[model samples]
Target: MSAQFIEKYRENAEIYTGSDICKQKSKELLLEINMPNGLLPMDDIEEVGYNRSTGFVWLTQKKPIQHRFTKIGKQVSYDTHVTAFVENRKMKKLHGVKAKEILIWITLNEICIDDPSSGKITFGTPTGISRIYPISAFEVEEDEKK
Candidate 1:
């Protein structure tokens, strides 16, 4: 993220540094917001920040990475910096994330579980395109320390 962007949101935000802490914090935030913990799967996270009052969250990593959700057969790319405004069951105004659709990469702007009971989750794009998939498709097993 740009220095100005970080400065504007860093005030009063809960910030955590280090890969381990950042990874844990990211998973915790996702669970708190009713999203799947495996949705991110970012590697080597350097920092994580969350501003409760504004519902803004940001994550910084050493480098960009692309991960494939094997269960769902989809590939998604995450940038070095990712930011979003999160709320219960929803994340909006997201930046720095994209999902590959066939041969094209679609920028994802929103993700929400409209009704938990429906067992569905929706991924939306800025251009009004969206796809709903079974929530189980994104569920992942937590890492077990060896």
Candidate 2:
């Protein structure tokens, strides 16, 4: 049957025929969201730390930019935030930057970072896992700063 009675039962029709596996729900979808803090190997993270209990590398979330940019009036515009974890303080010291500088560095490098010297953004993240949210979403946490 061609499912002419589907509307009566509120069923829908979507046709995609390529692989039979595509029609099946992912087994991974049922798995728990237990993403742990660990450095993505390709991230080229420096200053590795040791934890006797667990072998997990400490990692931080980084937003990746996946759009284009342009000049608006006299200011530059961007569409994404690139973020990630720095392995340790030594990485910062080696880069000659303090804690505050690191955060600013992320924003600065949101587009393309090309500083050849120490102040350049040295580390990289897994690329696609960076958090990309609207600035208004930060409102709830902003109140805590004051």
| Cα lDDT listed for each candidate | 0.92, 0.20
Winning model by TM-score: 1
Cα error, candidate 2, residue 142 (Å):
36
Q: What is the lDDT of residue 125 in candidate 1?
A: 100
Model 2: number of clashes? 6
Model 2: runs farther than 4 Å from truth? 1-33, 36-103, 106-146
What TM-score does model 2 achieve against the real structure? 0.14
What candidate 1 gets wrong by more than 4 Å, as runs, is 1-3, 143-146
For model 2, residues 53-110, the per-residue Cα lDDT tens digits are: 2211221112222221111111211221112122221111111111112223332222
Across residues 1-146, which tens digit of lDDT does each residue of candidate 1 receive? 45468679999999999999999899999999999888889979999999999999999999999999887899999999899999999999999899999999999999999999999999999999999988888877876635
Residue 89, model 1: lDDT of: 95
